[model samples]
Target: MSNLPEARASRNLHKTYEGGSSIVGVLQQYAHDAAPELLRESGVSFGLQNTLDGDPFTEATTPENRRASLLSLAPHTDEIQRFIPLYRHTIHPFVPLLVDIDEFELHVCEYLESRAAGDLRDGSKTLNQWLTGKGINTIAVILATLSCSSYFSDISITERSTTALKFVARAFQALQLANYMLRPSVEAVQTLLLLGNTLQNTGQSDGSWILLGTTIRLAQALGLHAANTKTRGANSRKKEALWSVIVWQDCFLSVCHGRPSGISKAQLKRLNFAAVTGPSLSYFEIMCRVGCLCVDLTEDVPTLKGSVDLVEAIDRCYSNALPHLQSLDKCRNLHQRLEFFALQINMSFTIAVVCRPAMKKLPPGSGEDHYHQFLTTRAKQSLFTTLRTFLAFQALSSMPLRNWSMLHSALTSMLLLSVWEETRHDPQSRDLQERLVGLLLAVSEESSSADTDSDGHPSYYTQWLSPRSIRTLIALQSAIRNTPPLTDHVSPTRSVETLLTTSEGASLHQTGLPVLDSQVPDQITALLGSSVAYDYDQFDWSTVDLSPFAFIDETVNMPFYDSSQSNGFI
Candidate 1:
């Protein structure tokens, strides 16, 4: 296939805009003169007119086919530019090196420009034409862009919502071009990890779980889990960094979902922890360690309740995590602060997991009961307080409105906390939830999107993709299939009812943990296996009904954590 020549800008158009304005100004001018929104959304045609001179897919592959792929996606350069910053801020704090922001922008800019003054092939050729842009470099850009749009949670919607959908469309196309199954490159593993995150974030947990499993296997086959730095013609440091992220996500999500971690300790040890030092990286490593503890607490229930050995081990792990929190004090940036928010929430979650067993079976009417009950109470209080602190920060921070996963997780905690507050009548908890809820609703309303066609008009499908789920692109899915977004319009009474209502659409006949607790008030149950409700806080989650909450002490982790013994962790 012969490569098509770049489109030449009209001499008159260039004469008027060239060096006369900033990119934004030129873009606005072009917008008024450009094709309609539908054509833009459908994207510039790269079909027969741009096909390889000779059916490159059927005949031998050629540079022309790669050129075709690059040109086909050229129209999206604006969106890529628009969302890249948001993605970097919202999602890149932990893995800052995933994509080279300036380099990618420069490369993409050249590809998009067809002016007589510049060469389109100059920076664009740096992309691996060998893989036809299905390689890591290209896929990373697509993943970063797609992730900028939440897959699952309903964040506030906006014109960016349409841009998000467009990126998703491009991502699907990019994956197809990558020949994902046929040739799994090292960068492909990161691409797969990112895509899994997208699916998981967008509320496709079932699919994401399956995709992650495939990713784990592929990563292992490629020896990505190993510490080898000189092999595979890849940057060992980069590979190690990728491995760290993959494992961290694997462990953390696995614990959250009550599934086993796919990359075991043995697998992790093989990935040499290169001398990585920094507040953010250290904090992430701490999270990975806590994820390991969560697995032990939830999945490995071999010891008898109140076993001295079991209690000590749990205490040791919890205490070990306290010092890691000190690392946050060293962080002096917004991204680090937001990352701290995630860690803080996860700490409460881990605390609850650690102490849950103490609640499983208490010796009623015995001194032992009081001891276990005290520990359990302290743990529960820790969970509530940590959640409240994070939520308070989240309300003032403006981070959640931009981060889908953060918002999603925060809301899930809010939903649970709201119920807790209702029963306990905690004014503090109520205040926190109320502030967050209002902010969430406001953002949703502000970002509401209604994309138009190339004629610069809206159509039904475009509206459907957005309409409601612009706050909920997941709404693009079947209402019956999705857990409906917690919308701003839905009143509190109805909202609770919607969430707590039995899923005639889904089923309770699933596996492991009190993920969706039974409606029982203040009690614990073993879901994957059967266990009795504890005497302490003897309410079953399964039996909880919406009602006025009683006021309770939302104590911080102080009572459960002793800084002196926490090995200076706190």
Candidate 2:
């Protein structure tokens, strides 16, 4: 046995040993027993044993079997330190052996030495080979690794300083190459999404966006966007794969700072209702883009309108998208996407309202007047109606408390916009005032009907009312009511006083059935009275509060909407 080389000896032992145990089983047993002893004897000096008395078993044969055997033995506390170099050196010559080892082991080996980084590239090539020859564990492993790295970057990057973005970029390129070399796999597209998300989180958004954009192009190239196919046949599978690619691409584009290239009108046309699984995901992407564009209040009206048009385009493509916003189907996922859409619409409406004064001044071109007027009215009314519907839906549906906060912030912002719009036109002001009264009444009714806690107080609105929303509402109201009068550049003291009186009086009388939070009404009054202007160090909220309604003044002191304090909505 010693005269025969190690490979031939192992082969002979396997052929000769005819017990109940298989060759694999016996090898496993031997490796288990020997690995610990080998480690103990070698101590700190063991660096990857490459030749096991060299009859030279195929590189593929020993690494997997030996690695398994070593694992079974559960060597010393320093098992990793001992096995890293050994596994690395042993697997070096065998391309197939690289594919057999698991990703975690690969990661461990890479962590042990920077030089081991080449193993991943080697492993990827091996996987490509395995996928091409006979579809087996390699494809699965590749998909799993991609997903594991994408969703759980902290785990994947445990020992590496590599950013999740760069890792995802590498994974995308690998998957793309694999697709070119092997059969198209849904697993590959899904892995791309995982990589996209990881890249987004790691601030390599540009790289991720470009990768996703390329994926969309690839899908289109493969005829994956064929609209007439929806079943599990070859055409349908291809289409489904392509749809996922497009959705992920859109998401990446929507979230990243700069727009990705390659998405043309033709591509957008392909993504109409017929090609998508549901409009929710695509709508969400459009909403994200809209949000990013409209966050800055000072952006040009045309720019804001461009954002609005993008959302409208989505709405046109997926007509059912808006109606599904309040539908109680798949509540959690539906609510999340709907909430984002709702916020985008509300912000767009605010933009329209802010731009209304400018709209009136634009010189009338042939059809521009009608178009501009329609946009102004339609955008505001649609936003208001949608917001009201959302609130009503929340009141009826057993949504989580966080939903309430979202609804509240939306309502607050809508109210502010309506009031601002009214202030712009006297006739519209009365109509808005009436609507505000009715909304307040509905809120009051809902709050009263809701179950109170042990302390007899309703749940706090913190879960929904993000700080930014609160600040936006305050600033919006401030802007509308305090706008310098057209007659003279007078201080906004009178306007502020009028707003304070009207709001306080409306709350006191429970006008139009307002949603009366006893705390909120008081807080609004106090904030109006106490908040001072930066220019004058004087307390503006003080003079505003010295009314006959002192009780109302004392109660309403806190900031109404926390999010209002920021640079408006985003």
Among these predicted structures, which one has the highest TM-score?
1
Q: What is the lDDT of residue 544 in candidate 1?
A: 30
Put down candidate 2 lDDT per residue, 1-570, tens digits, no spaces.
011123232221111111214443354456766674443333223321222322232243344443232223221224234323433222111111122244435534333342233222333333222222112222322333333233322222222113333434444444433332223334454455445544443324455566576555545534455444335566464454346445534632432232334444444444443333454443343433333333332232243345356446534443434434434453466444445444443434444433443223334454455455655565456445545545453453322112222333344334444343323334444344445444444443344344344664432321123222232333334333444333453444444344434544344354333232323323343345544332222334222323211222232223343322343211
Alpha carbon lDDT of residue 177, candidate 2? Answer: 30
lDDT score of residue 488 within candidate 2: 50
Give the Cα lDDT of each candidate.
0.44, 0.37
Q: In candidate 1, where is summed lDDT lowest over 10 consecutive residues?
A: 548-557
Error of 1 at 503 (Å): 22
Estimate the lDDT of model 2: 0.37
Which regions of candidate 1 deviate over 4 angstroms?
A: 1-67, 74-76, 94-143, 146-158, 229-234, 271-281, 296-336, 358-378, 402-404, 415-570
For candidate 2, the 10 contiguous residues with the lowest summed lDDT are 11-20
TM-score of 2: 0.36
Q: Across residues 320-431, which tens digit of lDDT does each residue of candidate 1 receive? A: 4433354567557765566666666665555544554453444456556655665556555654656565565565555444433454445444444433322224655545
